[model samples]
Target: MSGVVFLILLLLGLPLAFTLIASGMVYFAQNPELPTAVAVQRMVAASQSFPLLAVPFFILAGHVMNCSGITKRLIHVSNLLVAWISGGLAHVTIVLSALMGGVSGSAIADAAMQARILGEPMQASGLSKGFSAATITVSALITACIPPSIGLILYGYMGNVSIGKLFLAGLIPGLLLTLVLMLVVYLQARKKGFAPTQANPPSFKQILEAINQSKWALLFPVLLIVTIRFGIFTPSEAGAFAVLYACVVGRFAYRELTLSDITTSLSESVSDIGMIMLIILASGVVGYAIAYEQLPVSLTLAVTQVTEQPQLILLMALAILLVVGVVMEGTITVLLLTPILVPLMQSVGVDPVHFGILMLIMVTLGGTTPPVGIAMYAVCNILRCSTTDYVKAAVPLFIAVLALVVVLALYPPLVLFIPELLF
Candidate 1:
């Protein structure tokens, strides 16, 4: 009954956090035998987590970096390295996103940022509005997999997996996605006769200068992982360090950060943090109700009855996520589903960290897709491209991503290798 209400409320366009809270209240209303206080208790308990501190700090750091002129430097670096490629600006979009992954950590944020900065240039260079918007939006998927990813942090918090391990796990997959998207851009650009942005390759000196200028930005993720892996800081503390690091880099190294920037970053962080944490808290009620009902146990039993194969079971879960993702926002989906699916995958002998990467990617990818794709709307709106045109241009890029997803799904080591080696 609560599930049906959730779906109905969601389809009616109620805010996700409110929908979750209301549905949770309904669940309690439906079961008067249970104490009503449980719902409030669950909501409060959700906010008491220590590790959940990572979300706000990282979000603050991302906003700080964006304001500090870090994004501009990375964009400059990306253009230096990739602007001579056949698809020039398209490749720049992919590389910039790969670089932004460490800085932004949110796919929608990355997509909007890129669309604002790169979209006009791509179209002016003769790329269609649809293709440009599609490229910018799809490239943001790299942000979903990279270190400091908020989705991974939430998955780690909810599933009780190591946040550091999940961060490491995302590194290889993020790079792989970058390469795959670049290839797609190259082929598509060639077919469309899209010329290079630069006639000549960057000189060795230019490459060195570019990297030197952005070295601090590039080093952040590496430092984040090392500190966490070697016990220098907990993930929460690493987040604090991230904020400090961004401030110092922006204010001193780049000399682009200002007092006003810090104030703006704080303001933006508060809103982003509030929205995400509220959804998480609301999910606590739903989570408690699900647990009280032993939903994981029942679902695991039901799934295992159909097939014991871990890969096949994972495929089934992915399919379901794909469908759900089209309608729900990614963060909401992650919060609502992680508690249920993590245990189900664990029962089938799937590594939670491995599954986490796949799950985050699929859910985040959902935002680039259909009727309720926030990222899609964000990018398309910025580029002034229609949804129909964007979808048509995004098909090949989507195929590339789906193929990579299948490969990662079949081969667990690809996702787990980095974390295992470091830890």
Candidate 2:
């Protein structure tokens, strides 16, 4: 009955946090012996987690990197690397996304920023708006896969998985996705008659200059990995280092970060942190309710009854997560579902890190899909392309991504290779 009410409230469009609190309140009312103070305690305890401190620090670091002019330099370097290829601008979008993945770690933000910066130029250069929009949305998936990803952080926190392992594990798969998407973009551009932005490949001197100029931005992720690997800091502590690194790089190294920029970055980080923490807090309540109702055990038993094969069960779970992600916010879905699914995966002897990567990919990919995909809407709105056109342009790319997901699923080494090598 409590579960039903909670679903009804969520479907009726109440904010997730409010629906959670309201549902918990009703559960309390139905059992007067249950103390209302428990809700307060849970909410407070959720915020008190040391792992969660990574969330705010990373958020602030992302904003700081953007404000400090690191993002623009990275974009310039990405352009230099790919602008000589056929469908150069589209390749630019892909490469830029992969680079931005390390800095921003938010797909929606990457899509919107890319659309704003590159959409008009691409359209004016005879590229279709829908194609541009599709590429931006899909490539932005890279952001969610890279290190410092908030999605991975949340998954680690809720699933009791190692944050550093998740971060290291994503490296190769993310680059592979980039390579595949780049090929798709090239073929699509050839089909559509999209020409290279530059007639010749950039000279070695130009390439060297671009790299030197963007070295600071490039070194950020390396520093993070080294710091975490050496046990110099936990993932959360590394996040604090990230912020300080960005500040120093922006203010002293690049001489671009100003006092005003620092203030604005803080303001942006505060709002982002508030939204994320609220969803997480609400999810903590929902998670507690799910546990109180024995949802995980029931779900595990039901799923095991249908399939004893670990791979098949994982595929089924991935399919469910993909569908759920199409409508639900990725962070919310991760927080709500990780607990329910992790134990089930363990029962089947699947590595939690591998499953975590698969789960994160599904949810993040969902944001690029239709109906309620936040990144999709963001890109389409920026490009002024119809949903139908975007979907048409996106179909081939979507198929490519789905195929990649299948390959990753069938061969877990695609994700595990990097973590094993690095760790």
Candidate 3:
């Protein structure tokens, strides 16, 4: 009954956080035996999680980097590396997304940044606004699987999986998504007759200079991972380090960040943090209801009644996630559904870390999709592209990403190899 209400509310365009709280209240009403105050307690408890401290710090760090001119420098470096390809701006957008994944962690943020910075140039260079929007928005899936991905962090925290393992697990798949997206651009650009930004491939000297110029931004992820791996920082503390690193790099190295920029970043971070925190708070009640319902056990039984093959179970879960991603906001999906799905995977002998990367990718990929995709709307709005054209241009890229997800699903090592080696 509560599920029906929640879905109807969601369909009616109610805010997700309120919908969660309202649905949980309905559950409490139905039971009457349980105290209503439990919901309040759970909501407060959700915000008390120490690991959640990372959310705000990371959000601020991303904002700081964006305002400090680091994004432009990274864009310059990506262009030097790949703008010589057949689809110059398209390739740059993809590579920049991969790089930004380590820094920004939020796919929507990365997509919006690129759409604003690259969308017009792509148009000026003769690419359709729809294509430009689709490419930039979809490329953000790379960030969802990269280390420091907020979605991955949330999954790890909620599922009690090792955050470090999840980070390493995402490394290869994130890079693979980069290559796969680039290939899609190559084919589409070749067919469209899109010219490379550079008439010729950049020389080694030029590439090195570009790297030197962008070294500060490039070093961020490495520093973050190294600090976390060696016990210099916990995964949660890495968020604080990220904030400090961005500040230092922006102030001393780039010499571009200003007091006004910081004020703006903080103001923006507050908005993002408030929204996520509200969702987290409301989800606590939904989570409690699901647990009280023993939903994971029921799901496990339902799944096991089929084949019980770990691989097939995982495939089904991935498929379900892909569908869910198309309609749900990625962060909320991770927060609300991860608990339900993780146990089901564990029953089939699947590694939670491997599933974590797959889950993050598919869910984050959701934001690039239609009907309710935040990143999709952000790019289209920025580019002033029509949804129909955006959807049409996105079809091939969707197939490419979906194919990559299928391959990754079949081969666990592709996702787990680095985590095994590192840990």
Candidate 4:
């Protein structure tokens, strides 16, 4: 009865935090022997986690890097490398997304930022707003798969999975998505008569010059991977290093960061931290209620009964996650569902690291999809493209992403190979 009420509240558009609290309150009301204070206690305990410290620190690092002019340099380098391709600007959008993924791990942030930077120019250059919006929005999917992804961090912290392994596993799949999306962009651009705006391919010297300017920004991810793999730092410690690195690069290397930039970055980080932590803290009570009801056990039993084959089970689970993700925010779905699903995956012999990567990809993809995609909203709102127009332009890219997901699902080695070789 309580669970039914909770679902109804969520369906009726109550905020997730409030829905969680309301549901738990009802449970408490039904069982008068249980103190209402337990909900407060659980929420506090959830925020007190040591591992969760990494969230804010990494978020701060991301903001600082963006403000420090690293992002602009990256865009320059990306344009130099791909601006001569057939669908020059479209390809640039995809490549820049891959580059920015290292610095901005949030997909919505990446999409929104890219839209503002590229949308007007693309429009001025005879590109439709729908085309500009679709490319930027879909490419932001790359950010969701990069290392230090907030989604991966939340999954690890909640599911007791290895953050480093999840980070490593995402590398190949993320790159694959980039390639696939680029191909789709090329085909779509050709079909639509979009051509290279650049007069000629950049010279080797030009490419080298661009690389030299952006080398500091490019090195950030390599440093992070090396530190984590060599045991010089844990994931959390590396986040602190990232903050310091961003500051040094901003102030000394780029000479673009100012006191005002620092203050603004800090303020933005505080707001981001507040929203994420609030969701985490509130979801703790909900997680407890779900566990108290043996949701995982019941779910495992039910799934096993339906299918004994691990691959079939995984497909079914992915399908369910895709549907739920279409409606729920990616981070919230990851936090609330990972705990319920990880143990079930373990029972079916799926590697938790691999499962986490797939889960994150699927959920993030949902945010770009139709009906209720948050990232979709962000990009379309900024471009003033109707949802119908965005969908028409995005459908091919969506199919491309789905194909990539299917390939990764069928061949686990695509995910596991890099992690095994590196870690």
The collision pairs in model 3 are none
Tens digits of per-residue lDDT for model 1 on 270-345? Answer: 8888888899999999999989999989999999999999999999998888778778777888888899999999
Q: Once all C-alphas are superposed, what RMSD does model 1 give against the true structure?
A: 1.2
Candidate 1: residue 51 lDDT (0-100): 94
Put down candidate 3 lDDT per residue, 1-423, tens digits, no spaces: 999999999999999899999999999999998899998999998888888888888888899988887788988998888988998899999988888774454678788888888999988887888889889999989989887888888888889898888888888998999998899889998998888878899899998888888988899888888888778898889999898889888999988988988899999899888888899899999999989999999999998999879989998998888788877888889988999999999988999998999998888777788888888998899899999999998999999988998898899999999879878
- Against the true structure, candidate 2 reaches a TM-score of 0.96
- Model 2: weakest 10-residue lDDT segment is 98-107
Q: Tally clashes: model 3.
A: 0
Off by over 4 Å in 4: 1-14, 102-105
For residue 176, what is the lDDT in candidate 2? 83
For 274-334, candidate 4 gives per-residue lDDT tens digits of: 8778889888888888887899999999999998788888888888888888888788898
Mind sharing the TM-score for model 3?
0.97
lDDT score for candidate 2 against the true structure: 0.85
Preferred candidate (TM-score higher): 1 or 2: 1
Quote the lDDT for 97 in model 2: 72
Better of 3 and 4 by TM-score: 3
TM-score of each: 0.98, 0.96, 0.97, 0.96
Backbone clash count for every predicted candidate, in the order shown: 0, 0, 0, 0
Positional deviation of residue 210's Cα in model 4 after best superposition, in angstroms: 0.8
Candidate 1 wrong stretches, greater than 4 Å: 102-105
